[model samples]
Target: MSNVTTYKVTGMSCGHCEGAVSSELSEIEGVSAVQAAADTGLVTVTFTEEPDDEAVRAAVDEAGYELVGRA
Candidate 1:
């Protein structure tokens, strides 16, 4: 089964930001999908395997945003 998790993110303000965040998170090993909403600062990720929180955080960082933990 897939695991779905939502995380609160900061510093996303537009479509570009959303794309950046989505792009980075989608590259993670177990992530099967990603949806980032700039309006809510929420990122929902679907994972096919156990997720690595640190990797999630790093992806956000790489996209120049902050992962504020589960939403």
Candidate 2:
């Protein structure tokens, strides 16, 4: 089964920021899909398995954004 999670991110101000975050998250081993919205500062990730939330947060942090919360 697929495991999907949505995170509320902050400090994304442009499409470049979204693209960076998307690229980072997409490179993760189990990540199947990633959608990052600059306008809403939301990131939705779909994984082949239950991916580590910390990894996701780390990816965002590496991309120069902040993961505020998850749902």
Candidate 3:
């Protein structure tokens, strides 16, 4: 089954930032799609499996952004 998750991210100031976040999230094992918006500070991810929040956080952190929260 697939699930969609929205994560609140901080410190995204431009399109490049959004791209970076999106790229990182896309690399996750079960992630199917990633849409990141710098203006909204949100990253919406679709996954084929339930992904651990920590995994999401780590990917964002490695991309030089902060995962502030999720919905």
Winner by TM-score:
1
Preferred candidate (TM-score higher): 2 or 3: 3
lDDT of 1 at 61: 100
Which segments of candidate 1 are over 4 A away from where they belong?
Answer: none
Residues 38-66 of candidate 2: C-alpha lDDT, one tens digit per residue: 99888999999766888888999999999
Model 2 TM-score relative to the real fold: 0.91
lDDT of 1 at 49: 85
lDDT of 1 by residue, 1-71 (tens): 89999999999999999999999999999899999999999999999985789999999999999999999
lDDT of 3 by residue, 1-71 (tens): 78898999999999999999999889989999999999989899999986799999999999999999895
How big is the positional error of residue 71 in model 2, measured in Å on the Cα after superposition? 3.6
**Candidate 1: Cα lDDT at 32:** 94
**Top of the candidates by lDDT:** 1
> What is the alpha-carbon lDDT of model 2 when measured against the actual structure?
0.90
lDDT of 2 at 57: 86
RMSD to the hidden true structure, all candidates: 0.7, 1.1, 0.9
